[model samples]
Target: MKGLKVADINKAAGLRLHRRGGEAPAKASQQQPAALSKPGAAATASKNKNKENAASAKPGNNSKAVRLPAVKAKPAVVDVPPAAAAVPATGNAADRCTESLKKKYSEVGDVDNESEDCRDCLLVSAYVKDIFTYLQQLEISAAAVRPDFLQSPSRLQITPRMRTILCDWLVQVHQRFTLLPESLYLTYHIIDAFMSSDAGASVKKSEFQLIGVSAMLLASKYEEIYPPNVADFVYITDQAFTAAEIRATEQRLLKQLNFFLGYPLPIHFLRRYSKVAAATPAVHEAAKYLAELARADYSAAHLPPSGLAAGAFCLARELLPSREGACGGSGWTDALEVFSGYSRQQLEPLVRQIAGLAVRAGDNAKYTAIRKKYSSSSGSMVSTWPELDGTGEALRSAAGLS
Candidate 1:
């Protein structure tokens, strides 16, 4: 998985940009290094290929070439607060042990009894939320210092239909991972957020796929305790992308964001908050539902992924176990209440909407017809896993995305 090279992705993007700039084919070849001078290279030359396609397909006159402004890199520790300071933690050693025992006992009774996992899962959710809140505050400050750093487009420049198609494609790629729904959401948020600013025009639509892939790679490591290896990442895609290409793209994405890999996500914060509150099983379930829902929709992409996540946790607690009965529980609920503006009533509908989407997420046959149009090729650039068809089904059968 560590196989991707930064220079190659820069070269790839540079090559595409040069082609768009009308550099002659022969001259372009001369500019490339020996590594790309192979006889068959022309067949996969992204720059020239896009140039020809863009010329023949669209006759637009936007002669003013746009340069991507250099963005200031985020600090090594921008969004993360020292773990010691982020939360007023409760539960000394014994209480934690007790909770762990309870969860373990529940699990032994039935793995499918999600009610048991809720305690542990909510703990994980709280960590995700803490990180997210820290990230959100840091992201805001970072953007204030350098407005272009995290700016991006509100929507993909492509047609509305294309946007839907793009999301469908994302679902296919996500299937290959192991319990990385949060990672998928993070990847989507990063690309969508980064493109919101002027930096977007510098990137081509084809480049978007690579960005998504790289973000997923980074997110997997951050979220999953045991992430798939580079080979697994490549393997999961079923060879749609060569290991070399995926590796290269991963590096490029890192460079583009200046390696803000540690930026927090919402899942982290939610788990922590839930625990301190001693949330009931149902409230914890509702929080998980909100996080998953927030991840699947693009509109949710605009909010700092963490803020939306924290809000979800807050909302879930309010809705579940009856808000009136939750007062004496834990400090977690009180703390979350202060941070998230939403009340239980406000989030109920959104929660339902997300629940519906989660159920439908695995219903691939409905979107199969639309997805086929974009998945037309099996070249080194595109992933070709046949298992792509069963991803949604597998997700449904595996813990129901909660």
Candidate 2:
């Protein structure tokens, strides 16, 4: 399954922001309940009619929908043009997976499953569920850092505030390079995971920023198609550490963590949960903003990436005018409960915690990188949302972070 990309979400929200003048987000595309599709002359006629309607759609409409082949029919062969093959494009992973699921389980057609646009894409491998399960188990392994790792005896020099400063700086570096969101999240995870391991005990205060830069180097190598050259990373730091030092620190970080970099991120969880909840673009964008904010807070260490993602999503629905008409009447659904493994009761405190962080994000003077990053038009100026403009009971209780 494809995960939702930060860029895509931002672009989607940017469209709504400019077009709707920031009114409640227009409803996500929804599919209606339909009788079982059958293969026959009538079905064929109906399919042709739908095709004609789709063909006549206005510019920027999201579909160029094609008819699905009849069951057990011999498929026709088509010759692909060289240019079409060279220009690779497919829906994001979540969209493709949602499309696959929708075909198998059309009963939920009344909901916006987020798959309609990728109707022509191929389905993923059958073991994808097993992959998610394996990653979930990995989330608990020794590869992860403990909460309050800065207070541990092995790493005495680094402070929570120091880590916060480093992370905030890295967010700016990430945007300056226009790196993927996975790289940003993974870069910080590498730093924390390395710090937790005994090998990193020797790391000094002078080398702290070096460790951060190296972690980004390593993460970009893992996540980017064309990572920045070592020279670019070196220059980004004003050559404080030479390219050689960065390469050395990257090796140190990976060796300390036993080269484990595939730990799932909150963005991963948010994408899946958003579809399950039928969350609107606005709600999903809010969740994305909160999840990214979680990357910088030491307090967020208390929640696993999945829980952090789940919390952001749950709170977003509450904070925003929700998708009441989408699926299961708006709030947390039984389907979400089953898939996310989070109940309404379990999520309340977490929601408030993330909400507190999201609501007050712009107020913090010391660390404003994330807030500034989201305030731009590409982010749809999400940091300035009126929904987050108040201090409600949710923000009042157990005052905390995203």
Candidate 3:
């Protein structure tokens, strides 16, 4: 693989930070110091020759200067807790990656044009490789620690429709707070994992909403820098539950899951695979729409995150208009399979399921939340596009499904 620049990689991977840099530059004031344009002229002119002589004549001047007590400024108040005191002051992974890229560029200064591009490509490849390796480890760990549906069939009160409804509501809540995609995925994982546990078998249907919101709350805290407050969650619920009830439910859900909330999410896999495919924004949006739709359906729960991501990516490619060199060929599919550890054949069934889900979300009113969300301009309006119907059938045919 050719080395790519970090800026280019960031753009391709959708990790570009949209935020403005720290405080705006201070404006220049009209008032000027007396020494303007004449270096040290004001200070030199202000000095008294007599005072200098008088100070030099004093024999105890050195002792007096030394005797002056050192004054110290008080430390500024930091909002961080003592437990997080040991954390590095440096920013997140993306920021660190950018800094490393800058350092590499500086060190390679004035190199031949061709060599510089090659070196940049190599540096980018190395950075991406490191990130992919870390995600691979996480994928393995997530599979190992993933919660199982151990409860007897009779004990499972939460039906598929109920799960779908909960997920739909969560989508609205997620949008209301403008939470990160990771938070939404984590919320789903947390809720499902808790419900599948032994303790969650006895939870009443009335408490389902509370459990769902609490899961989202925990996910936000884990994935967001400024997570929404519990009161905000309560308000989103139209004050159906009190702050105390929500907190209590949060504790219960956490205990049921044994505090294992770090499971790998489909979004994580989607990011990596999309980069490998070099998918366009439209395709990426379509893929995300399919993935989010999967969250609402119980059938998707059986599929692992890796399989889900591959399926969504496959569907996204099909949905996009056919352009020369635009779609992933055999090599691309093989690369995704190797990276995600799921062959095309293995991913086909999930792909079909996701396609069906996407179609239904558009055609059916019950699944309208997800469809409506994707219809908005801010969402890229991927859901409202007319290509889904024909593309879905094509995806099904290609997947060897009826």
Candidate 4:
């Protein structure tokens, strides 16, 4: 971790102070410093000035001049919460992977070249491929966690339609809280896991919504930077589920999941595949809409996250008019096949399923939350496209998938 530098916060005469050479810059006294006309003049001047300056500038130096907290500042009235527990100084596996991504991208080619924009971010992490590899392994177990609860004769209280309704309502709660994308996906996974497990046997028909709200609260705490409080969650439920009920159910749900919160989401796979195609912003958003739209679908629950991601990306490419020559003007290409590890033929079925969901999104009032949410300006209104009415050949082909 990098320590805060006092020099960064305390500027002297709109000029940076030098903690070196036992003297300030001759230009420091000047109201306006002379402009450097020559290339590397700043570097040349910095080298000639002082060695002590470099030592002071380095993070964690013992110099009092460099310590940020040592300097005094005015205080303000603010509600101070209790001190949080000590955060680990060392990086976790995810942290380590992100740190590695901060390195420069040195590979050649248009695909690699385009990704230079996201260099030094987790989007282009070096370990991204390996991370997804582990996620793929992890998803196998997660898939089994959600049994055929819809088809199970033993679970009579919850119906497939009820699951869809709960998911739709949860989407509204998710947007209301402005939670992360993972929280929405994880919430659904928790709901599915709990609904299918032995814990689901005790659920009454009236308690289904309670379970949805509680699962989302648990997911928000796990994924959000600052999750909403239990009171906020209760308020979102119209006070139907009290804070006590939500907290208690959260505890039960966590135990039922055996504390395993991580699930391989379709969005995770779509990111990698989107990079491969060099997909446009509209296309990427459309893919996300499709993938998220699938969450309301109980049938897609049995499908792999990667397939859903790949299919969504492929279908998005078809739905939106292409401005670039992505994938050689084809929906699927050799690079896509190599990266996604799925063939065009393999994606056809899932593409049809996703397309039907999109086509019926508006007409189906039961699933209107997703469509209406996407139709908003914040989502770029991808759902409002007239093409989704099924008049477009792309949508029709995707729907038929013959």
Q: Model 4, stretches more than 4 Å misplaced?
A: 1-124, 143-147, 153-155, 323-329
Candidate models: Cα lDDT each: 0.47, 0.66, 0.64, 0.68
- C-alpha displacement of 99 in model 2, angstroms? 28
Q: Which segments of model 2 are wrong by more than 4 Å?
A: 1-128, 153-155, 322-330, 389-402
Top candidate on lDDT is 4
Tens digits of per-residue lDDT for model 2, 1-402: 011133433343332221112356789999997756674868789999999887778677877769898788788542221111111112222422333333333433322224553353343323333444555555665376677777776557878887888888788777767778889988888888777767666777888888888998899889876677677766666657798898888887777777878888878878877766667787888778878887678877646677688777876676665433444333566556545445567677777677667666656777788888878987777777766533544444424532
Worst 10 residues of 1 by lDDT: 378-387
Residues 209-292, model 3: lDDT tens digits: 888889999998898877777766655665677999989998998777668787778897787777655567878888888888
Clashing pairs in 2: 1-93, 2-93, 2-94
How does each model score on TM-score? 0.46, 0.67, 0.64, 0.69
Q: lDDT tens digits, residues 40-159, model 4?
A: 988988886778687777879876654456767879532111100111112223422221222211122234334664477655555555576667656764534454775685756788
Give the Å shift of residue 83 in candidate 1.
13
RMSD of each: 25.5, 17.7, 15.1, 18.8
